[model samples]
Target: MRTTLLFAFLLAALSGFAQDNFTITGDGDGFQEGDKIFLSYRSVKGFIEDSVTVHNKSFRFSGSVSGPVRASLYRNQNPKYANVIFDAATVYLEKGNITLHSSDTLRHSANAGTPLNTDYDELRAALRPYFDKLTTLRDPYELSDQEQKDKALVARLKSIYHNQVDLMVPVQFSFVDKHPSSYVSLVTLSELIRDSRWIDKVEGSFSKLSPELKSSVLGESIKQKIQLGKRISVGTLAKDFAQPDVNGKTIRLSDYRGKYVLLDFWASWCGPCRAENPNVLSAYNKYKSKGFTVLSVSIDEKKDKEKWLKAIKEDGMIWTQLSDLKGNDNLPYKIYGITTIPANLLISPDGVVIAKDLKREALHSTLANIFK
Candidate 1:
């Protein structure tokens, strides 16, 4: 009887000892000491709320988290600004300049009954592509031309990384809905927006989610950003420009005010333009008889002037050819936002831009519709 009583006492003491850590008492007394806490108390991981270590008087969570992070107690006094979002799914913890790799064991709270280990595995699997893509390329922002050639493997690996991230969005969001927690949705949605196609589709999708989920983090703030990208696009008027031509003759784009002007932008080094010359020559022949004129503008440097003139002559350019001989100072380019080589603009006689990116058949069809 004595031995049995001793054994029972030891068991009770061990149970009490195990329960003696952090005791939670927040808005909801939902967490206990052994329960793993997700650091992000905000919507979409804005700041991290670290793990709480309990002492005699109060429970304390103190450790360095990388991102905007803080702490909050369970009950009212909430001395710290740490956000404690009350949803039970999976929450991801990440630090700056560090990758939360596949091999690392992620921790979670047992009290909430969260399957965090599995959740963490999925999150890691989803995030792998982003880190992989980043490491593949030497930072292209400051790469030497020769270095780029030497690192072609980087491009291939980077493509794999980007492609993987794209693949993860739908899968990650599916996990969000399956888990049914604010924390899960917050993290999944954030991942979706990072370099996402869904960024373009956020409003339609964001509007459909739980009101708090959308409004708290992915709310009006994200809406404004999307609207900003919608400023103006192509198919707009080519802004007017005036620049000196080959013989130092000044020409304003407005000069051909009442004629069908094919304003062509090309550079001396443009191989596609050289190859397309035959088609352009044919189109010119067919249409020149019927109120058509081509104005070819070159944005070549002065050192390449001879090459420019020779290419024009060799390619049988019968159209009026002009140049500014200042590469980026091609005034028309700045006006119309010509970002690529061999861009073309078509202007009506009354100076309204009717078509852009006009290729062989499309060019013919646009003219046929306009002239007819």
Candidate 2:
């Protein structure tokens, strides 16, 4: 999922909280005099942006927030000059007198005066080195022919990148375990929901939150996600639905019971979905004779039917394609709780969900294992 979209959704989810005034004070090192610093938080009303001028290595921002919000502090200088962005800190305005302290750079920052911020500070401190290494490993450059020749070494770097991310999950889980009543745990679980495989475990941790916290925006959103998880999670039987294909022939998910089916939720306007078509085509071609097939359910609206059909033909998707032509109101997407494109469910011959959102190499690797 796109980071900004997730943050936007989270902002909407956090709308139902009591308002409280907040005051943030900070002192920094390695910043010149008169440097501007920004403090912003996401709210239902949109981004709450505020700034303070650095005087004697100290600054402050005051505002009102509906609840505990994920906030950031950054050097308000032009990116072309220098960009120093602090780790996103969960600020509990409901708790009083928040203090932010950073030295050398915003990466080495600390917070106090609230339990939530304190716990978040610890998490940031522990995760910083791994994140830094991940950033270095992910530096973009074209692969040289010599580098391409060493597939094993290339795969190792990719593995390291993924491992760094997986390693943080346990650290986050531990934080939730230690601070069951804190809203920080809710925020942590919200971030973890990107991987639906962890939904069940996250829901369990969510159950540990205080009633007040559970009723907050983050808490209610988690509940909705848990419900969504129950419906489409792996091992659950795929829901049966009949929708008309492009030719107006009714097609049903149940009809593909004896074959592995990829229930693809996408749209013609979805760039990521279009980009993934070739990979899906490759998987379909490779596995079709082994009782595998794809069932694409588009969420395109009625007016865009021509565009949808054109894309299908251009993409060479010679498979079962259907759509209700209702855009986001399409039944399959709504039922599956699909918020993003390029999402899919790999179902077994018995119609049980075997995996989900398998893309590119993961799709091929899973198909290889299944047909091996």
Candidate 3:
């Protein structure tokens, strides 16, 4: 399963609360006088972005947040150089004074002096080893091109990667269980839900949250996601919707009835989605003549139509591609409750969702079996 960060969704769900003040003080060895630092977080009004100038090699910011909201500090904002100088730090903005320290770049900064930030740091410390292990195990390029073609080697790598994820899930859930009232707990649960394959476990864990936490904006959003997830579970008929193809022709899911269809949800900006395209293309080639076809829905923004078209051509995706150019609000995307990219539904000839999220070797094996 692919994981997507839903910070925007979580921030949007926040309810109104009495205003609480926060102050952030930071210093970095690499900072110079008059250097600009940008801080961004969600507010009740919507997204909030502000910048501060360094004085005497230190910077300070004061703000009011209704409740704890995740905020990021950036060293650079130039779009062209942003990726190159991607120095940033995340801290939970809450009621109190928060401190940030970095020897060189904000990327390696440490946040403290606030309850939520402290807990966030502790959680990161606890999970660092597991994340490191997963990093080492999940590098697809670690193997030679010929070795990557070996199904057994790929499967083994995937199995090991999943094992690491399984081990990490409990630690995350335990943090939520231990810090029921902490806003950080809600954030942790949201992250877990993003990558978790176990829906029942996710639902159960959500149910265990404190009433106050459960009724919070993020909680209600999560509740709705779980409900929507159940609707598209295996055996449920795939929901039908219409979207415009690249040539501006309307296409509907029902139009593809009487043949197997893979409802592929992806975006050009998504690295994982791009990486998985080759596998999807391979599956399409192997099964297209066998009454199977791929229908891709891109969540690319309206402004990125060129990027979308360019990606489709570069990926050599001969399959039909569709999108509404509505980014996250893409109608069919929300209808299916998809929160992550590289998600798909394998619909049987009768339009029943036979399987979902098949990838890598699983995609090949499943298609092989169906065609055989």
Q: In candidate 1, what are the lDDT values of residues 1-372, reduced to their tens digit?
A: 999999999998766433111222222233334444333354233544545433222232323332221122232223255354333323332222211211112222221212333454566566556646656645432456565454344344434544554566666666666554444455455545533235545445555566665555344555544453232133455467777766788888788777888888787688756645555666677788788888888888889999988898888888878777888677666556554556577887777676665654556677778667
Ranking by lDDT: 3, 2, 1
Q: Which candidate is the best by lDDT?
A: 3
Error of 3 at 334 (Å): 4.3
Model 2, residue 18: C-alpha shift (Å): 5.9
lDDT of each: 0.54, 0.79, 0.84
Model 3, CA-based lDDT:
0.84
2 against 3, candidate with superior lDDT: 3
Per-candidate clashes, comma-separated: 12, 0, 0
Task: Work out the TM-score per prediction.
Answer: 0.40, 0.74, 0.76
Off by over 4 Å in 2: 1-19, 32-35, 44-46, 55-57, 77-92, 139-159, 242-258, 266-282, 298-327, 339-342, 357-362
| Model 3 ranges with Cα > 4 A deviation | 1-17, 28-35, 53-58, 77-81, 102-104, 134-167, 195-198, 240-244, 247-259, 268-271, 289-291, 299-307, 323-331, 368-372
Candidate 1 displacement at residue 323 in angstroms:
1.8
